[model samples]
Target: MPRYSSRQELVQEMRKRARLFIGEFEEIAEQDKDTLLADVDRSPAQMIAYQLGWMKLIQQWERDEQAGLTVVTPHPDYKWNQLGPLYQSFYETYQDWTLVALMAEFEQQVAHMIDLTLSFSEEEFQQSGSRKWAGSTPANWPVWKWIHINTVAPFKSFRTKIRKWKKIKNGLERIL
Candidate 1:
């Protein structure tokens, strides 16, 4: 939810949140990545896949636009209301990978996203309609907003989810 005025600030926050999110998963056992609990909506592996999915989608939109192709918001196969199915596809896409591999991919994707973000100009970060794909949304967010929404925002939110998951797994909570 933090608003960044500069690309440097955006990247800094992105990297910081990513570290915090990934750090939460470090202590989780690889064998337990797919273990679903009674409370948490997603498993550890699902969390990584969800992040990876959105990051890849953002990169794809940028790549498609840069290549002079019509870029899709979300995807051609899915609409805004179809997000649940889209997320399921994301989980299925990376389900076979080990937790360690998913984490590595997530880290790598974050780096790639940061690099892509740096390629934009300060003006582009502030101005709406900078990218057709980004502008297509009802919110009409700029490129930086898209990046922050997919990266920093979710990283912070999901970090909390992972913390709760860890607490439950470790039985570190009280019934009160």
Candidate 2:
């Protein structure tokens, strides 16, 4: 039997999960410059970039679909390496947003993508061609899972971080 459901519905679930990330993102943003600068194992930007990557792929898929440009034959720019540049460009352009707001944009973009793809009829969706999809980066076969993973996983991470940071921030605030 052929598989069904173009995307994993993970992004949709992630939309809810992303909300849990907001509080953590706020604490991280509110971190004293000293704390963030001293412990530089990773930047918040790095974490945001990962989510940005998934959101971007969703955005691109939506764009192509709207343009009626299906069958995304693999091209050099469409490669994984190219994804970094697109992400960096987004960061550079949207540098003003706080982490929470950026997360909101991420949620919005993914939701738009899911709305676009989820509406596809079986005939339109199952047209498996030379198309490159977000899930295509992992294993093309489990595109739906990739979609869900990309959409939901980051938000879950965001939520966990938020919860931890909020607790810490609250404690720190109590000390003052």
Candidate 3:
């Protein structure tokens, strides 16, 4: 029998996948601990490593929403300048069953997501698609963060093609 189909089942599945992904991260991280991974191998590790971190963040956010938690929208400010040292640390702890400091840092961010669920009202969600999305789970459709996208999308229309303004469209408007 299939183990899961409902929401709870799905969350459990995601957690399980996260665990497995961690295992893979350790496998790769161990291999490179003593040396820099070639460009071929290193970049993917970086990407998956980063995404694994983000998955934890997104899931914690989802759990809060499921429980009707409330807060404001969140800006993406988790990572900025620190990466090289973190990667070096990962290389230092390769192949261990235990977590490297980078993983610990990621786990800490996940915990913060729990604390900072970006709580918002339904109205706020309508105003910003991402406010609603911040609470969504990966089990659902992959979230497309539209927080950066304005509520009104700017797309050129047929009118743009047809309209020709007579020259004096002055920057300063006439007072009538």
Candidate 4:
């Protein structure tokens, strides 16, 4: 993903990648959502859940900061180095949700994230350390970078994963 110069560019990419990513889930059978493939690490359900986790976390961080609380970079419970467990926690968090529900919630969260992005001014998007929660990283990344990483970047990568999973699943079906 390219560096977003403005919030509009960021939001545009968010919607574009998110649409493509979520669209792939339409072909995934609900029963197969949790079916892990030999190649792809994440099931269809896990992929959506991971997205929801990050979207919600970003929203929460902004909410906390707005409420005048010191914001934690990722989450209060997990440290930067413990991201593996953190991701597992995300999987567990939405494990019971049906794939449809997960996708619906992800869509809603994407819209909310877009709204949140629009809420920020161009100056905030461009300037590093604009948001305390966002700047806690060593690089002091701008708000747009955080948004791009959490949204557009992962959406594209996860889309590829799901596509690969789909092909693998189809191949297995044919062989069996």
Candidate 3's residue-wise lDDT over 1-176, tens digit each?
13222333333443444344444434333333323222223432343344433444355455666677752223133232454554444443333333364455545543343233234333443332444444433322223232111110100111121111101111112422
Q: State each model's C-alpha RMSD to the native.
A: 2.3, 5.4, 19.8, 0.8
Kindly report the root-mean-square deviation of model 2 from the true structure over all alpha carbons. 5.4
User: Candidates 2 and 3: which is better by lDDT?
Assistant: 2
- Candidate 2 on 78-137: residue-level lDDT in tens? 555675565566556556566666657766776675675566554445554334553344
Model 3 segments more than 4 A misplaced? 1-4, 27-49, 56-99, 106-131, 134-176
lDDT of 4 by residue, 35-111 (tens): 99988999999899889999999999999999999998699999999988989999999999998899999999999
lDDT of 3: 0.35
Relative to the unseen true structure, what is the C-alpha lDDT of residue 145 in candidate 2, on a scale of 0 to 100? 43
* Candidates ranked by TM-score: 4, 1, 2, 3
Off by over 4 Å in 2: 1-12, 26-46, 65-78, 81-87, 122-131, 134-138, 161-176
- Against the unseen true structure, what C-alpha lDDT does each candidate score? 0.92, 0.53, 0.35, 0.92
- The residue-level lDDT of candidate 4 at 30 comes to 88
- TM-score to true structure, per model: 0.95, 0.57, 0.33, 0.98
- Which sections of candidate 1 miss by over 4 Å? 172-176
The TM-score of candidate 3 is 0.33
